[model samples]
Target: MIAQLTALERTYAAIILVVIMCVGVAMAVVGRGDLFAVHGWIIAAYAMAVMVVLLRDIDAPEPWEEHFREYYDDPTKVGIILSLIWGVIAMAIGVWVASLLAWPDLTFDAAWASFGRLRPVHTSGVIFGFGGNALIATSFHVLQRTTRARLPDQLSPWFVLLGYNLFCVLAATGYLMGMTQSKEYAEPEWYADLWLVVVWVVYFAIYIRTLARRREPHIYVANWYYMAFILVVAILHIVNNLAVPVSIGHAKSYSLFSGVQDAMTQWWYGHNAVAFFLTSGFLGMMYYYLPKRAGRPIYSYRMSIISFWGITFMYMWAGSHHLHYTALPHWVQTLGMVFSLVLLVPSWASAGNALLTLNGAWHKVRDDAVLRFMMLAAIFYGITTFEGSFMAIRAVNSLSHYTDWTVGHVHVGALGWVAMITFGSLYALVPWMWKRPALYSARLVEVHFWLALAGTVVYVFAMWNSGIIQGLMWRTYDPNGTLTYSFLDTLVAMHPYYIARAFGGLLFLTGIVIAFYNIWMTITLPAPVDEGAASDLPVEPPAPRAWAQAGE
Candidate 1:
């Protein structure tokens, strides 16, 4: 095992271990009995685990071929594993928070368990922890394969993966410790935000370095989307999170912008976080994985190029729509609305391109659970983007703003689109990474598909109903022009829908648990032998299609 690691891996592992130990010690010195103390102890234990894995060489034995060393990096496997682990943790927290919304008494008198704190934890856990890892992992895998070039350096890949996750850890724990900049999606305080900037810059460098070394004549469409996501996110994050720290040791900070400017900045960051982080990054995943899994080439590379440019141009201006009916200037709000409405064209262009790519692969869509997941994801992308466009309109925004409808719209993208696509990609990725012929259980994949689909339907519909009802009740008027329904009356009406949403979350959580079990078994269990093969011999699966091949 030790013989297999290049000097680069050993050096990176040692650096990571030292950093972990140092951070743990620093936390102990400063954080004493706070949540940071608990975080420090966990870091120490994690360092020990890393020591054992790095020293013991738990990776499978390397292939004998020399060329195998030049094409792929193994850190992608680690990224995938972390993505799934974080997905489960995030969804579990999401379910707990949903239950809290339904029954506020569930807080159990614990301030840490309150919805405000845990909400950020769930959002960051899923967005940065789960979704971020997926982007990193898939981007690395896709960039190499599409470019037909090896990563420039092994150590940098590991550094990006571990460093990005460490930032996620800090953000999550900071939320629990009541640390925030009070920005919607950019809540992590000054220090954590600065740490992320360092990590993200390294990430961008890694992408550019790999691209510069590509053997392919033309860069693939997918990498363009990924690069846009990486670059635009860095800009948005730095601009939105600019603040003055109270002290080097303290976790508090004040925003550079105040009042209306601050609100505009936050929503701009918030909406675009959805755009670039969730939508653009995942679109990159779709461009590669969807067609690859369906055994088809992209429907129209030209259309994809158009969609890519359109989305990037339109999404940035659309953030001001989130400030509709607020103190933000009316002209700015109208401009945002127009841009958001225009965004629908490019959004559908991408979604349609994916669906059309599967034109001849309907049979695969039926038989392959992975394809089913990706197909549903594309459909949801279309639905959610259309819904978003409508909601951005001034008339529709009047009813949708501050309502569960917005929440429902988000999950249509998050749970139905982002998570489904991620699960499908991972299902495809796990077997390849572990050198297994297939997943441990195909039946479990089918079961999980249904569970996820059903859960999303129930959850979205419940929220839609709740939102519309709340909107109607709020605007209702008596003969004397008094309110027709009290706010408490609307709350009472929403109780059933809240409970239904929680049930939907429970169903989704069950699917995630099943997926985790399947992935675990795939890694740990031995491959099955063919019917007529020797007992000691395991069957190797057929090679993937050209587009699906790793490192080309």
Candidate 2:
């Protein structure tokens, strides 16, 4: 990828790295006796390392100017590899966390080894590190194809990709150092949050600039979802992360909100992070990849547009449902619940639209593991949205709140819907990105599909059973009105389920390892002997004399 870069671009890149190194040094000097100082060193060291790599390739022959007119995919390739690496690491951390629940003495006695410290690492790694990278990579690829336009500039795409990753690394390390804003998904402190804001603005600019350069007159449905994902997430991050840092050098900050308002704000960010970042971004992927892989057009474009606006309008109000039966106002809670129930229409509309798009492709889904991955993801998306809406009700929340049921519900969405769709998309994307005829092994794709399915089922069922049992035990009462089950009893009952959960997570992590090996081998496969000057896409059949080509 680096060998193709023009000399001027490489020189500009090196100059930027030098500036970053100076900033890192200043940060290191200013932030002594705090984790901020350590991150400063990380920044400086990372800048220097990338600089050396750029220097090594600085003198390579420039790429063809004609090739520059094609889609700029170097950043997408790097993003894919990085996403897989983060997925493995984060899933492994998740397995360790599950084990810790089963046996608390699993880790060495250290501050960073505690479950509290490591839990956020696992969450941030999977959500931002793994899932976020996948979104960014796919969005770049989808944007270009749907619009028939190359990215506006090579340098800015690199800035968005690597700069965003820098934020992720800072977030992961800061968690280990016990520095946090103490919010749920918005845990990274003010510095990291500010860095993300900078990265995101550039990301948005890339989207906007590329659209302005599009050859196609009408933007595709996939780009609409991607744009919504980008815009909404920017708003959510800035508003929820508002805070005053203790100092420029210190790693502490206080939220601008206090009390119930704070709780409302945090969950508002949390749930929409799921909505836009997790759901909408992946939905964009699903719209493009599923139809392409199945060799079918979307069944109803009209329904897709309707679903898009419905989801955008309703999900913002639904986040308040998470604070049900709390100190939040009754009307606000009721409003949230109402919107959440209404949200099921659009959610299921999307899910159903995807399924109906598979009208003639059911046979392909049965035979093609790649298609099956997406098929199951759609089913899970439907089921999970229904579960989320059901749980939003006040009556259900009474039993489910503060119970493992909530945890179970989250995994149903995460493991079943999010991870499944991501893997499906990558499976379809990897061969095209590498210009390969096929993956290293088709059987291995089958192996991965089954293992992932099994793991998700096992993990979710254990949580459901354990959660219900925990909730029941806590609520059990005697005739005298005293609780029959102590809190310790609930803890004791969870032991077996925790062990089951760990085993399930290990199974999922094992599938990730297998995928890593498969993808590595695919990337390393030698080019075809007759493949000179050929695009990765398959040749399309010649159309009838009267039929038009591209769809709206």
Candidate 3:
């Protein structure tokens, strides 16, 4: 069975096993305390499990035939599984943090359970762990299909997938250990950042190589958005994470920039991390999956091209809006604001294009749960972008900044746009990847969709109301020009909204849990057999779809 594996697969397995063993030994020898020791044990146990799996596969019989051997999807399968796992973890943490806000004593005085430490865990887990893996997986799947070419190599895909997840693990664990460079959305310490750089470079190389070998003359618009996401994220990550590590073994690091410069640099990274990482990559998913599921061509391929370039160009300049009224130069702030407002054009263009593509498919959008998710995501994208532009204006920023309004806006995109699109894509892909006819439960899909929509709406409204109330209270002045409301009074007022936010998050999480179960059963349950079948033979797979055939 081991002999059945391609040489590359065997080599990868051996290398991973060796690396895991070496890391475990090193940690056992020089780990600082119980935390490090426990981590080492976990690594060792995981390595052992991996070894067993490899050995079992080695002993299995080789396949008699290898049809559909042109494409690589194992990495995608791994990514989807990891994405679901991380989604649960990220949302659970988010709910817990919301609870912390509502009931401050929920932390129980434990440092590790504090909101500050866990907040990054939620953000990084969802963005990088959940969303990032989905992007990586779908990008590979979509890029290959759109280009009509296979990935450059099998090993590189595995390296990027596994190595990227490793970076996520390091980032999440480091946060728990109080190790960070203090950069929003770039919280991973110096070493973790370096690891991600290496992984990202390999990903880029694989993508470019595959594109170069494409059978199609025109690169699909989806690939363009995906490429932009990869290129810009690499540039932003490296630039923002230029820090000096205390030592090779230690997690401590100091940023290369300081003071006002540091603040500007951090927000520059923060905002664009939203733009490229969260927005662009998922837009790539939207472009591919939406049309494929809707059975229609893109509304305007030309508009997609325009929106892609416009968004990429405009987003880089808009980050400074985050520093409105800060020590950053006034002109720079204004520049950020102007660019942010201009960003609405391309944002709405993309959203409109997506919606217009569904012009004759409204019935499908209404009937199909997956299409509903994508359509809602596109709609939310427009709403969030419009709101973001409005809030960037100086006058609006004066009220929204330092308030939960910004939080609400972020989730309008994060939960409504990002997660919704991701869920839709996964619903469309999981059965295909597993060679199933359909989802295990369509009813569950419908249920999950309504839960997600309800949860997101409730969550956003609660935050918006709390934020406006807080802003009003802060700005209210008495007849004598003294503050009318104290800070504690605002906190007391926010308690109800915070509780609502937590309840909303719980609803969202419940939906995710249902999704996970449905996917799990879809993959594991035996396919239903035909009633009148005479012989006991495996069913032949269906022929490829038109788009898939064209790509090939």
Candidate 4:
């Protein structure tokens, strides 16, 4: 990967790392005796190590002329690997988290391992660490293909990839150290959030720059969704993380908004983080790879347009539904509920468009586990989006709020939609990326598909059961008008379902393990040349651009 850069580029990379190292050292010195100092040391050591690698490779040869002709994919490759590793780690932690609730003594007296601290580690790890990496990696692949142009530069992709990972590392480690601003989904401290803002700006710049370099007459739908993901997420992260740090040395901060404003700001960020980051980005992946793999054009281009605009316009307003029946004014909640229900139109449109694209590809769906993964993901997308709309209603929110139903709804999206589509895209991408005819073992792919499906079903079902029982128990009353069940009673009732949820999560994690191994073997093992494999490689690399020929 380092050899992909020119000598000058390598030197530039080293210089960038030098600046990061200096920042880390300054942080370490100023934040002595604090956990923030630990992160400083981590950052410094990481930067120094990467800087050394760049320096050692600084004099190495630049890529051949053929390199600039092709898409820059090193970052995507590394991003995929990092994403898989994080997915396995985070999903395992998720299972452990579920077990903690069931047993309530599984922490083993470790403060860092407590449910409060580790839950965010699990959430942020999978969401940002795993899912974020996948989105960035796949976006690079989709963008270059859709635009018929290479990335604007090599170094910026790595900068965005590594810098974003640094933010993930900071957020995860800080959570373990109990350093949080207490906002859901935006838990990282002020410095980490600021670092992300810087990284995201560069990411957005890279997208715009690449689009400017496109040879195509028009941007593809995939780029539109990916751009929305990039643009909207940057806006959401910046606004929600606006905080005043107590001191530069301290890993603590107060939000710019407080009271109900803080609550509103947070859910706004939270919901749209789901909208753009999880839904929109993966929809981009779907728009590209799903049709490509199925050998069909999208069913309705106009519907795709409707889906994009509707989601973009509506999702921002739906966040207030999360505050239903709270101190937040009823009108705001009603507005949120209305938007949430209306969001179903575009949500279903996107889902329907994906499914209809497979009209004549049912044979492939039957024979190919990879396509099955994507198809099920679309189905789940439809189901979960509908569930979200249903739960957003004030009456439904009353039962679902603070219950395991909400958790179920999220996992439907997380496990069923996000993870499924990601794995499907990766499975489709890995062989093509590694230049293999097919996977190392098709049987393993089948095994993984079934495991993932079974896991999602069991997990969601268990949560649904757990949530409804809890909701009903909490609201049930005796003749004396007192609640019939204590919170503990609900816990005891949901204990079995928690165990089931954990087991289901374990199944899902096992599938990811299988996927990682399958992908690793496909990359490492030699391909057997055969007729079936010869025609599978893509033929989309455009003629080298004029500036690229000039070695710019």
Q: What lDDT would each prediction earn against the true structure? A: 0.86, 0.89, 0.87, 0.92
Query: Per-residue CA lDDT of candidate 1, range 63-128, in tens?
Result: 334634455647788898899889899899999999998899988988888899999999999998
Model with the higher lDDT, candidate 3 or 4: 4
TM-score of model 3 (CA atoms): 0.92
Q: What is the lDDT of residue 193 in candidate 1?
A: 81
For this target, which candidate reaches the highest lDDT against the unseen true structure?
Answer: 4
- Candidate 2 Cα outliers beyond 4 Å, as residue runs: 528-552
In candidate 3, stretches whose alpha carbon ends up further than 4 angstroms from where it belongs are: 1-5, 20-52, 55-68, 530-552
Candidate 2 has which clashing residue pairs, if any?
none
Error of 2 at 505 (Å): 0.9
Worst 10 residues of 3 by lDDT: 59-68
In terms of lDDT, model 2 sits at 0.89
Off by over 4 Å in 4: 529-552
The regions of model 1 sitting more than 4 angstroms off are 1-4, 16-20, 23-70, 531-552
lDDT of 2 at 1: 62
The sequence of per-residue lDDT tens digits that candidate 4 reaches over residues 79-180 is 999999999999999999989988879999999989999999999999999999999999999989888999999999999999999999999999999999
Q: Report the alpha-carbon TM-score of model 1 versus the true structure.
A: 0.91
What would the per-residue lDDT of candidate 3 be over residues 402-506, giving only the tens digit for each residue? 999999999999999999999999999997777777899999999999999999999999999999999999999999999999999999999999999999999
TM-score of each: 0.91, 0.95, 0.92, 0.96
